[model samples]
Target: MTDPGMKCTRCRQPARFRLPAHNAHFCDPCLDLFFKRQVQKAIKDYAMLRPGQEVLVAVSGGKDSLALWLTLEELGYRTAGVHLCLEMGEFSEASLQSCRQMAARLGRPLHEASLGQLTDGLSMQEIVWATRRQFCSVCGTFKRHFLNRLCLELGFDTVATGHHLDDEAGRLLGNLIHNHLDYLQAMWPVLESGGDAATGFARKVKPLCRLEGAEIRAFAQVHELPVAQGKCAGSKGATLLYYQKAMDQLEADMPGTKHNFYLEFLRQKAAPPPPPQLGGRCQICGAPTMSELCGVCRMLAQARQWREKRRARLAAEEAAAPTP
Candidate 1:
């Protein structure tokens, strides 16, 4: 039992945080200990990592990711950080700096990639415009591909992400609402390596899946971890954001609703059938794809074609102009 005005659950100190999902309140130190123990339990329960295996943590300098990296390192894991700069101007630069600071604090190596480098100097906005696709979809595809490639190239056995319980619950609700069976089936704490091994699509793990977003943010703030403080510029009015808000409202109305929903999803024994194979490797990038080219490869190709057409049109217009 917890009293809102009482001392910490584990200690006599004044309580600083309350976790409604767990029905517990804790002081700063106790909260930190509780958060770390939950993360360790999640890892053990899911077998997310094996001892001595190298891990590349996908860090965005956000609270959840930075906190995850710190916790993994503290738990004696061989973890390194990878930051992808989506070339979203100041956001990208600030994220990179935060990642650098975190790596320095942990005294670990940090690898970096950028949308420009991956897309031939094209920014995310440019790629979206060139492909006429949704910004989030295009960005997500590129980041997934880029991270997997990096993990393989760097000889990491697993790639860790900062997907917490709230994220999982919200995503599940979204899938349920939209009837996205394939995606829902693929949602798990751990996903085995898929695609061609030669290209380095390593297994994915989420050690923070059992924890909530608010708790993770609290942990980060308590520890003063270096994390980017703002949301991405492009995520405004995104469908995912709407789903998250809805989940939050539901959770507020019914305590532990999110935790219960997420745990039930994991406990269900009937595994959904695997999705139908989408065919062979992409022709251009050798990535797994249903079509002739993977989404990333196809988007890049389209961007290239668009650029050429624009250049040719500009040249023709300039030629048609009278002597200037």
Candidate 2:
């Protein structure tokens, strides 16, 4: 027996309010449909997909990725879901299972890559603890690296990611805060070929970029796509999580904050500037960068320096403390 109100997906309680678009009997289903449509439209308007091209989808077995996979298949794009099993603990097993179940249900080919194979003895936990960086970055880098490599190796022409509007907006805001204008420019509908590992040789696009997170959540609920609930173990204290939380809080207080900010971002018009010149490859990675060293290598170098400084501080503190 169901209550009169729409039901929540995470919790089986009746939804607080009616979502009109999906004609949701429950809030979750309504949100799911809304997100799917938004993703479908974004793909079409941005020309993100080609009819015959095989899309190498990076599935985390979560709502966002699952929604993307199903929607792309529904829209007639031939897709194969590829999952990277980071093996972060019990969560890794669950994530892998979710990925397999979803792929089997959707009847699409699913490929899996393991971090253990790629890391050359560096586990995800080792990288996070050693680098003093969140596992999200390492996991993201490895995932993107593996995804693109898999695509190129398998002859896939493009890669599709489930980065929605909220993710994009939060990223843009994060860039603004950090003054990383180059990355801001790189976040376009069709990214120009460059240093990005994901697009080194194959094109990559985000069909779900225009949709909101809530909408994606709703779409998944309506379609009843099998998605696992829980945060990535490596994501517990990630910087992106903090930024996302801040953005979510702001959006909650000021509804549509992310949506409106991005709409205005799209509508932005600026005075014409000089024509752009071409770029050369970085000496280290052969990837295009404004400087001789690519941004990624440059950042890693800075991180190493920061790590050294932090170690020295910790050592000094330990020396200064009286023996117990």
Candidate 3:
């Protein structure tokens, strides 16, 4: 017994459906084949996963992360869920709870760390306020650094993130706008030699980079995976949104616009500049860096400087304003 017609996830056309493993309803013939091929292609094209290797999945309780963890498990890779609680009030609690429930439902093990534990008594808000950097950079840096370090400490050979095709395209285009060839080349599916003091041999992989965020949303809907539909509580500003909207407009004008961008870039014989030559690991922490202090610390100091200048400017403006 099957529905004769179902909405296609990709093209959004009414079409027949077939059940994908893990209880997902995918459109028959075209979309089904497309999805399967996408998954296989990503795996083969990037060498995302290796046989019998353990993967630490950075789960955010979102469609993409959940889909990735489930897919890896279904594909027989040993997956350990890694979640970070940013301690952003209620939002953080809800995210952590949702992740825990999903892990329980799937009978998968999950590892978690809190921002409070990692930073020196610094909340994400404080970090942003002090560093004068935008919200995304502060949070992103802490999360990525913590995740990699945790993976190394835990002895996992590879770290998997839930960056989808749309995200990848966005980064590529952003880099292209600024001509950041080194960063662009780092967009490969697999990132080997993800250096960290704890796990000197940690590599990072992105298996879902070929799948669109929309596809992951569709998969979540088909499987009824629990997820948050709202934006992150800690999210603010407009740089990322502006870029995403611009790219979205391109996709609207031309179907598969994002995919084509990546495909075309891959066809180019472009490799990033050789890895940076490091003098020595930071005496405080053993992570890759050039100066005595790493980028994270430098960024944090810059954020603080920005905040001080902003405060002074505001105070000067207030003092100069005529009395009402």
Error of 3 at 216 (Å): 0.7
Per-model CA lDDT versus the true structure: 0.84, 0.70, 0.72
Q: What's the residue-level lDDT of 216 in candidate 3? A: 71
Model 3 superposed RMSD (Cα): 6.0
Task: Write candidate 2's Cα lDDT for 246-294 as tens digits.
Answer: 8888877776688677656755722212222337666765554468875
- Those runs of model 2 whose alpha carbons end farther than 4 Å from true positions after fitting are 1-33, 194-199, 269-324
Candidate 1 residues 192-265, lDDT tens each?
77655566258888999888888997898789998876678877666787888998998888879988898888
State which candidate, 1 or 3, has the greater TM-score: 1
Q: For model 2, what is the C-alpha lDDT against the true structure?
A: 0.70
The collision pairs in model 3 are 130-303, 130-304, 131-303, 131-304, 132-303
Candidate 2 vs candidate 3, lDDT winner: 3
User: RMSD of each candidate?
Assistant: 2.7, 6.6, 6.0
Best by TM-score: 1
Q: Give per-model TM-scores.
A: 0.92, 0.74, 0.81
Q: Which stretches of model 1 miss by more than 4 angstroms?
A: 1-6, 270-279, 314-324
How well does candidate 3 match the true structure in TM-score terms?
0.81
Model 3, CA-based lDDT: 0.72
